[model samples]
Target: MKNSSAADSVVLGPRPQYPIESVDNALRILLLLGERSELRLTEVAEYLGVASSTAHRLLAMLHYRGFIRQDRRSKAYVPGTALTGVAFSILQQFDVRQTLRPFLEELRDETGETVHVATLDGTTVRFIDAIESPRAVRVASRLGRSMPANCTSTGKAMLASLSTERLHQLYPEEELPGLTEHSIRSRAALEREIAGIRRRGYATSSEESEEGVSSVSVAFPAEHSALRLSFNTAMPVSRVKRADIKRIAELMRSTVDRAAALLH
Candidate 1:
């Protein structure tokens, strides 16, 4: 049988071209590696919910690209030097972590609470930097921790900047996870809250992401032209009283403007 030419093989509506599975697995692998310095193939497979053979194939590809390497002693896989190089490059140039560390530190000094900078990655927000509070009873949120966007002030602040089209594209009217009683579950309610954030120029979550914890966030403009940088402050509700929201919001606004100017 004669094979069809390449031009004749073009039949589709919108086509899916990117390696979605591999990319998802890659991200999952990176997340797992960030949590632990190393992982076994079985553990990786279990984490990704893929067959051992499939996991091996993905791991082999990553190994080839120097994203993951096999240890000589433990025979376990870990992030490679090349990945570190890529991460450094990203941090030096574009990652939110590097861009906002100084600002976060300043904010921490000003507020005396844990200050964080976070950005949206899919439906979750990734904490890029954190400055710990000096007090004994402090709320510790570390860098690289991914939390639900719908239940976080930083996440909401970024989400508020999105257009309705973009919001729909990012989160469909489907099974939105609810972490606590304060979690936004309905599309209408979420839309309203996001609109409020846009109007108010900040976001607040009252024990939505965690019990007895309150967070305030303001999004800063970044060079990406699409992405938004969020400044997050997590403190006890008792500490940051209702009377203090205005002052905190003012500080966030000033710091974010300065950070944005620095980036530009």
Candidate 2:
């Protein structure tokens, strides 16, 4: 028994004891990259509060794996095409568009608005599929477009799924970007908002992304994949009242559930 205990301790020593802090820092770096097109090594190091050498090491590793890249002439780092490629592969690998087409069409039919399927790409949301309404006044989102997480209902739905510990780790206690007057600016306030979203089971945005447009979103928990899928319907503010938003949430949740089932 003594020998066995000693052997077990050696094996478990390699296991992570401080996963939260490390992951939190890693996520912060990713979030910063999402808001900007590119960053230099010194800029990333300053942002992470690490030594320049340490940050360069981390950046180099990410670049090596195709998660990030640096412009040769500008010497600035940008989110690599690897992420976009992975996003494409994810949709194709799961054949999500083919499986979810019926549900998306149904959502557009019921809401008379533009419906979209989006996935979390790092701290941004990327639209995988979209169906536009027949009305000329309806809002529309382009496929493959990536938007800031703090600025969209679909992004908020995914953010709502993370734990408070995880959320703080993502935003940190320092400066959080505000793209519009309605964007979440403080980590604490955002945490409360995220908690409320978890309780309510859906997310909403009113002109956070763009003025005169509103959206509501829900997430789908598919069995086979660890990643959650989310969908949203964008409409003109004139056409999207509080009750109408609620109805859209209901329709989106139902459709997402069906899509998740088929996706799995």
Candidate 3:
């Protein structure tokens, strides 16, 4: 999995009423394990945007819970019995990631950009899976990360399906936090953009969530008030021409349509 360069990445979604930093950090550590067989203390610290000592405590707790085990020699933590058991149980039921990865892969191949499958998680959008573009210059995958619904094309695409009252409820604040200067910073702006998304059947962001990155996205299960889903093709803003955005958005819209049917 790929991540934004920012080490101090915060949850960009609507702030939780009773957020627990420790639990969130520990969950982040588990997410990192999905991309590698093992993790070092330093890597966890950097990824979680925490100090090495803080990372160590989180790792120790996970190790005690049988979710991870530190290798005696390398001091790297690997998945443990409890984690494996949970994975086996989940996979046996149905692997949503496995079922949807091919669609993202196809989108990446068509657009020559990183493709992500994200789901609405309350006021946030969670990237459940992603396929990175193989190009030397391209946006990185965003697997297992969540961002504000209005800050990302993937999030906005889904948010467009929601009613104004619903959106207002989700974003009760007049002012919204922004990751970059280009991000939507108010409820009115987001609602206006969402109106355009509804008209265009797609959503876009130019350096909204991250500097120098732009993306075009389409949502599935069109207008679903619940379980709204979406995918986006992200690339360097410099490489994103108007023509390319149109081409990519068309392809993504079609792919998402098929995916919505298949998933249903």
The numbered model that scores best in lDDT is 3
Instruction: Sort by lDDT, best first.
Output: 3, 1, 2
- Count of clashes in candidate 1: 0
Residues 28-131, candidate 1: write the lDDT tens digits.
Answer: 67666655546788887877778889889989888999888886655788667677657644753665566678888888898888998776655678777788
Question: What tens-digit string does per-residue lDDT give for candidate 3 at 1-264?
Answer: 323433225356886899998997787788667555478988888777778898899999999999998765556787777886576445335655677778888987787788887777546777877889999998887887879888999889988876775576567777987889999999899989999999999999999999999999898864331245788889998897899999998998788777776665
Per-residue lDDT value at 83 in model 2: 58
What is the C-alpha lDDT profile of model 2 across 168-259, one tens digit per residue?
54565555676688877677766676777788789998888878888888977634344557888888888877888777787777777667
Candidate 1: pairs in clash: none
Looking at candidate 3, what is the lDDT of residue 57? 95
Candidate 1 residue 201 C-alpha distance from true site, Å: 0.4
lDDT of each: 0.77, 0.73, 0.79
lDDT of 1: 0.77
The clash tally of candidate 2 reads: 0
Which structure among the candidates has the greatest TM-score? 2
